[model samples]
Target: MSLDAEFERVSMPLENPFTISRGTQTAAENVVVRVTDEAGMTGVGGAAPSSHYGETADTVEAVMPDLLDAVERVGDPHALHAIESELRAVVEGNPAARCAVSIAVHDLAAKRLGVPLHRLWGLDPSDAPKTSFTIGLDDTDRVREKAADAVEAGHSVLKIKLGTVRDRELVDAVREAAPDARLRVDANEAWTPKEAVRKAEWLADRDVEFVEQPVPAENPEGLRYVYERSELPVAADESCVTAADVPAIADRCDIANLKLMKTGGLLEARRAIAAARAHGLEVMCGCMVESNASIAAAAQLAPLLDYADLDGSLLLAEDPYAGINLSDGEIRLAEQDRAGTGARPAEE
Candidate 1:
């Protein structure tokens, strides 16, 4: 049987751009993809939104007509290669658009197999994966306070969104607040390699994990500059969107930040992880403001990653569907059993 691609726009307001100091976002402005085959089974896909990462509702919306027009008639949506090709031509490194198409196809395929997405992706394991909660940049006192509360709430790892040149104060506040928590910082292209070094120096060995995308993606030289000088390790976020980047970015960064939005979806993300691993780079799965449909798809790829931050759903003031169990920083597979793309959150 054949499959047809369907697309729609959804807007879910965020309680806050899920503040990490780099920027702000109001809603989960997203593109929802559904691929229904001749057998009446449907697969779902979700796209993550990030204006700072160079994605917008307009870009997502604008890309859809062309994407659906091309892939709608593909003879085999389940064939990963074919779907990938159509998707790359349409969405590519654009994150949001690519993610939806990748997800819809995977969702359809998983539904056909009658298995949880994780099982289909070979990411299912008995133990749940630990997920890092975020601490958006706020006043020194507020940053400490939020970290304390969230850490007490059972999140053991904290990913701090550090804006330009604000690293010292935020890191100090976080360290003072949650001394025992594993810590990483995301610059979101806010700092230069030199500034990143200055920032990482303050918390070099004291309760600091790594620094991500200290500079912008295009400046791999700056990333390498930071990687060579910073006391803490550097990871690539905006600097990496696919497997192709892993080799080019290998020498410049110690880790790679793989977001569902960035890698497109679970399958492509998994392949990206393999490529990252092969280059001897550690992986961290990240997310933007999205629903559980996106989180669950990325969750399947978490086991293969060294770290994860799939808390985008947590930032939602309200989530319509209950997709997965994320208790105390753990993502359990309770929601993976449902049919149709394992996007249990989309069922609502």
Candidate 2:
């Protein structure tokens, strides 16, 4: 059966300004893709572009028409690799755009087979770990409030954003508010190697589980320097982009945070996971601030990861799609009876 594809731009407001070390976003700019087979089944996917990765809403919009055209030419949605190669030939470095098509194809294939994506992948939903709710960079009071809210919402893990002079104060405030919540921090490449080492030691004392991207992505030596001296586990978010980048930094960091937006989609994400494991680096599945469409697609890979930061949809003031359910930080995937990614447009 032939396939038809289409895309639309979407903007979802955040519950509050989501400030990371790089910048702040009051809303997320995303592109949603839908693919329909001649059989009349439709599958949905989305991309949340990041400027840090050289992708913006404008870039995504510019590349999507050709990308979708490439997808439409593919004869089989199940033949993901063939479709991926065709799309890659159409454009370069637009991972988010590639991701939108890759996921839409996967969703369509799963739907055609009449199985939920996780089931089709032979994964057990119960094995999927609980996701961590993020507390973005903010004033100490707002940090405390966000931490408190996460704890009250039954989230067992809280990933805090750091990389400022107030880093220590923010961690202290969050700990005070949610004493029992597992704490993790992402510096977003804001620290020097020496600063990262110092902060890691300080954070270890505060019971921080791990530190993410403490040093800049471009500085593998800085990452290695901190990893060698720090008492806490160091995770490479910015440092690791694709599976090929994994082996080079595998010895420098304890964990690799893989996001669909970075790897281009689930196919590459799975490959990156295997690559990380091959190099003895643990894996964390993460996402950008996106709607449920993309978050749900990322959620399908949760069973294969050691950690999950798939709360992007939860950060939205309103999500137009629904798929995964987070109860007390636990990730509950859509039922097996549902087809494709099991994420559909919200019913008003």
**Global Cα RMSD, each model:** 2.5, 1.1
TM-scores vs. true structure, each candidate = 0.90, 0.98
Of candidate 2, the 10-residue stretch with the lowest lDDT total is 333-342
lDDT tens per residue, model 2, 1-348: 688899999999999999998889999999999999888888899989999899999999999999988888876799899999898899978999899888888999999898889989998888898899999999999999999999999998999999899999999999999999899999999999999998888899999999999999888899999999999999999899899899988889999999999999788899999999999999999899988888888989999999999999989998888877764678887443477777888882
lDDT at residue 312 of model 1 (Cα atoms) = 84
Tens-digit lDDT track of model 1 for 239-347 = 8887778899999998988887876656677788899989999888888877776776777666677888888888787765456667578877655557544465534
Q: Candidate 1, residue 205: CA error in Å?
A: 4.1
In model 2, what is the error at residue 278, expressed in angstroms?
0.3
Q: What TM-score does candidate 1 get on C-alpha atoms?
A: 0.90
| Candidate 2 positional error at 171, Å | 0.4
Q: Who wins the lDDT comparison?
A: 2
